[model samples]
Target chain A: MTHQDRGAADGTPRLLRSGALQLETGGRLPEVSLAFRTWGRLNPDGSNAVLVLHALTGDAQVADGPEGAHGWWRGLVGPGRVIDTERYFVLAPAALGGCSGTTGPASAAPDGQAWGSRFPFITLRDMAALEARLLDLLGLASWHTVIGGSMGGARALEWAATQPERVRHCVVIASCAASTAEQIAWAQAQTAAIRLDPAFRGGDYYRHDDAPRVGLGIARRLAHLSYRAEPELESRFGRAPQGAETPLGSPDRQRRGRYAVESYLDHQAEKLVGRFDANAYLSLTEALMSHDVGRGRGGVDAALGQLDAVEFFVAAVDSDRLYLPGQSEALAAALPGKPGVEYIHSSMGHDGFLTQAEQLEPQLRARVFG
Target chain B: MTHQDRGAADGTPRLLRSGALQLETGGRLPEVSLAFRTWGRLNPDGSNAVLVLHALTGDAQVADGPEGAHGWWRGLVGPGRVIDTERYFVLAPAALGGCSGTTGPASAAPDGQAWGSRFPFITLRDMAALEARLLDLLGLASWHTVIGGSMGGARALEWAATQPERVRHCVVIASCAASTAEQIAWAQAQTAAIRLDPAFRGGDYYRHDDAPRVGLGIARRLAHLSYRAEPELESRFGRAPQGAETPLGSPDRQRRGRYAVESYLDHQAEKLVGRFDANAYLSLTEALMSHDVGRGRGGVDAALGQLDAVEFFVAAVDSDRLYLPGQSEALAAALPGKPGVEYIHSSMGHDGFLTQAEQLEPQLRARVFG
Candidate 1:
């Protein structure tokens, strides 16, 4: 099925460009259009399948989509790319409990009402389960590989652990085995920002005024900072004045948000608010905060022991603050038998997977495709 | 002035324990007490003075106090230490917009009303101004040094730039020249959590039933995670069980907040609530969000130019998520004339200044005393 847009003006995921398909969230809402795209042709028997999961704000279009030619993983998924779609049937699905297609707070209900705040909370595992169902519907049993980044990486890990027989390989990049207190805290903080926006109206913004765009903007700005490095920010906008004047007063006399950095944050906020759903952001953020694959599996060490059969290819960003590169190292170490792990050195904090496509491609090809 | 507890359960900044001083936030109810302890006999000249600023949720007593000498930085402030009380005449005052022994929301006002939600918004510079006034009240002239970490480091940067003559040396550790979009976002998130709490009651929780402890807990948990290393968490927690079993189900079958790491986060949350005021936390967190040394300067590079005369010792924590070491590097690079910079490697995140006291002491002594 070709991916389609669901009346969205600025697209679904903050990063995704197109391919909106509807899916059921199993909540109060009906099936929601999920925006997704596929890379590489589906081989006969579909045994050469590789599922690519996106992070908290990721979508289906991994690298190039059919009509939406622009690829998220531009250099990594084409021709002889690391995740060469040409060689494998690659499926990048919008995560469950997300704003993109799959039933989320933005989906319409049987009553012709948008789910809005009526959506039930979902967990990382729930998202993985939804993907499993989608696989079943597609008449394909996972065989080749499962790859994910950040939150996507977490889902990939869960898929490997929960359904070991479904796949032959696993590639988790720039993500943790379970959400850390720090990750949970960051997620909680983002969730609160959306909720605090006066317009949020307790997730009932749909029926009321516009979404908590300001709050969501602020949230996006914050996440953007974590997604990139301090040096990168400095190199790009080191306190230069915006085209506008400083709002507080004279420079050297007052203190306020005057630098270009501040302006950059403002721009980010504006972009996110215009494109993303506040409730979906909050719900997905909460799901990330609640993620803990090893919660009931003894401890992280013991829990990792459950994935004895999985082949691991983990990646970490050197300058990532959200998912510190060291977490990747630890995840690799904790697995029963040490799994192959690597680092994707980049100044783009946790979003390195998208930006460092060239570096990640080889890793994906050697471990997953080979 | 003898620092002794003026016995009163009233939540006021009191000269509780030894060297503790009590004062109400100006024009507010709930006279808060500031439990402070002075180090080194204040020289008759008072000019041989150094002010050690603490980060958010930090108190005045850096070492021993009536509360059995509990302090976050016990290693750096003792006799013959880096900030040796014997000669340097050091003063570490609780910040004005704080929950500890200071006029904060939880403190009872003269009218028996807790400032709660009534406190005015404050900025980082405003906080420094209050401390400057405190210095004036103490009869101190030019301070020999202004040393701080994290938010405290921001204060030090402000002191040297805003009051260049007053501070001869500025020691900034694990801090940024300005709060990045990401940092502000994190602060906003924490604020939202507290504000959204029904118990927060618009910050007047004292008059209401529940304090926004859950929200505050969540905030602290997030902050604590930022202050420590990602790998450290994996090594320490790694999904370890909390020793006890679930009453509702078998330990093996249980799925809840069962990990020791989760318990550790709970402990941190409880500790903050036991001693901190939620309103003060909101204020300080906002202040941090608003922190920007380059706000009114020509630019970040131009802002650093203002520090031409001030001596600087820049430090960074390798694992700190909030204040990445790269920030220090950027600040050092921006400084017109190259300044001495130190990178302190530690597993502890931003809190490395407190947790790795032994490693910090010699550095503090060499920089502050030498």
Candidate 2:
């Protein structure tokens, strides 16, 4: 294949570059390239394109990622799934501050060196802006729909508000128009977990074999707790010791054993440590912290008012403490139809947005895509 | 002042020593001494003695501790307060595994060395047993009331179940009949935070100038979040950057700045790190994790059924995410009369049990203290 055609190889990561990316804050990057993956072909009219946004710690692989690993939303988007790629061209871009094949802090700058600690400040708005540019590079004047959840939802809302004509449909699940104080607080704690680690070295540890795994582990532990409901945790793990490892013993014995829940969290942390980047986590987390759809628009109502033409389907998990149903209701109230928040019932907390696909398929089909 | 009489001095920390304190799980301490503070006088009839239990990080001083530190429950129990010290003799004992003037890991063993990493595993049952012994040394055959919240509530419930006649009335707030899986999960995360720190030195960091402050800080942060409601956090600090520290900036700026909520949590962690012992924190936390009153007594219902003779006043925080109101309702349902759960409404979560004392006063005055 020719060098130009090589970019279209199966599972190949596509990059969208810009000469100088200006941030919402005054900081600027000399060069920026966002990694992305695509499934299905764009219709000649380019009217059937669908954007798939991922949450924090998620990459561009919404469908078939390299290595054939299952994509995060694999159940919701495919040949004949809810967001059916058989009929619509689907594109999932790794976020601006993300690490997975994206031009994040781990990516080399114009100097041919990793950005390290020099990566510019990024906001949710900046990320949305960069993704908009990326979409333009793919020759897409406007997308048929923009779909995401949690942090992804934040970007989808921003896209809808920032360019009303660009997005025909917006689906936000288990997220709010802005990061609430509690959300910020949790994010702050997670960031502190990474930043306080001696191994973090102010985010310039690219050369180190270890990359603040302990800190990242702690962060993941906190985040994982938020992702699932307390009831789920209580029923699943309770105070049960891992296997035959009883907690009633000496400190040495206690140290050797773990509660089942702790072991579950440890597994989660280990999984992330094996694949994720700590600096990118910090960057995307900060970007999420900067999520405010109404920052320039007068307020949340006014911001949603800006999306007069975009069809919106906003949903909340009944058990989601992170993004309560109340926030979703508020978002729905601000939309054109003033729709009531759709409910996605699950014992899982915030993660129900991802796990309860069958329950969501009808709603996604009828309101967002059908 | 004579040595014996000195124990009765105002705010004096009374120590009751046993040759060896045997643990429920087969571990043993060479010796154990419980620290307690008393206020008012026990009437000759011994009918006016009131045992006050402190929460996880609390000390012997329920009304007043050393260095003039106010008691943790100072708002609820004092002259003219809900418990009314004027009408009853008040006693607050430092928990068995606690640090303040009590026999904990910070306390010396028979060899005149800090227990440190060698400290044996302690259960909630052990804490109750030690307190029972301490009460026996006080020459009080029985207490008119056992009042507590959180860990104190756990002890109070244990006292009522383990020795029915010794406690005439029991008040438990923002606590459950057993540590749920979610509670255990949170505790596990906290314990892992301490254990993961290399500075922990296998929990024998007593000789080090610094005691795993970073790890302890993380634990405190996580615990503190669970102790407060999301809405409260959102309203109080909602995405607000710490004063003069905008979230937008380079890595250096991001590193230097913090969200206001982070600062609040930092203050909390710093305050605890200064006074609380990490090993003791772990001990008490583990004690809390082992707090299933139903363990040997069938289940939670059968366990609470053991409190047949005790007058029970069970209450919950309306917003408590940790010890949920449902758990409290469950506790009430299993009581002798199947008493309805009383709720203390407030923006605070589990902490409402400590802060919203005024709302609890009326209920305490009539039902519990009456």
Q: Model 2, A229-336: lDDT tens per residue?
A: 988887888778888876555544345466687788889999998889898998888888778888868878888875779889898999998888899998898888
**Considering every candidate listed, which one attains the maximal TM-score?**
2
Please report, as a residue range, the 10-residue window in candidate 1 chain A with the lowest summed lDDT.
A2-11
Docking class of 2: medium
Model 1 lDDT tens row, A1-370? 3222221221124222223332222322234344455555666676777778888777676776545556666666665776665676677778766876777777776577776666666677667666675466456767578888888888888888778778678888888877775565455446555665668886777877566876687567657766777667766764345667552323221133445666767677787777678888877776776566676577678877777677777888777878877678889988767875687878777778778857866666666677
If you assessed candidate 1 against the hidden native complex, which CAPRI class would it receive? Answer: incorrect
Q: What lDDT score goes with residue A227 in model 1?
A: 79
Residue range B141-232, candidate 2, lDDT tens digits: 78899988998998899888888889899998889898887888778778777776668888788778878887888789888989999888
DockQ of 1: 0.13
Q: Pick the candidate with the highest DockQ.
A: 2
Q: List the residue pairs that clash in candidate 2.
A: A181-B238, A238-B181
The per-model lDDT (C-alpha) reads: 0.67, 0.81
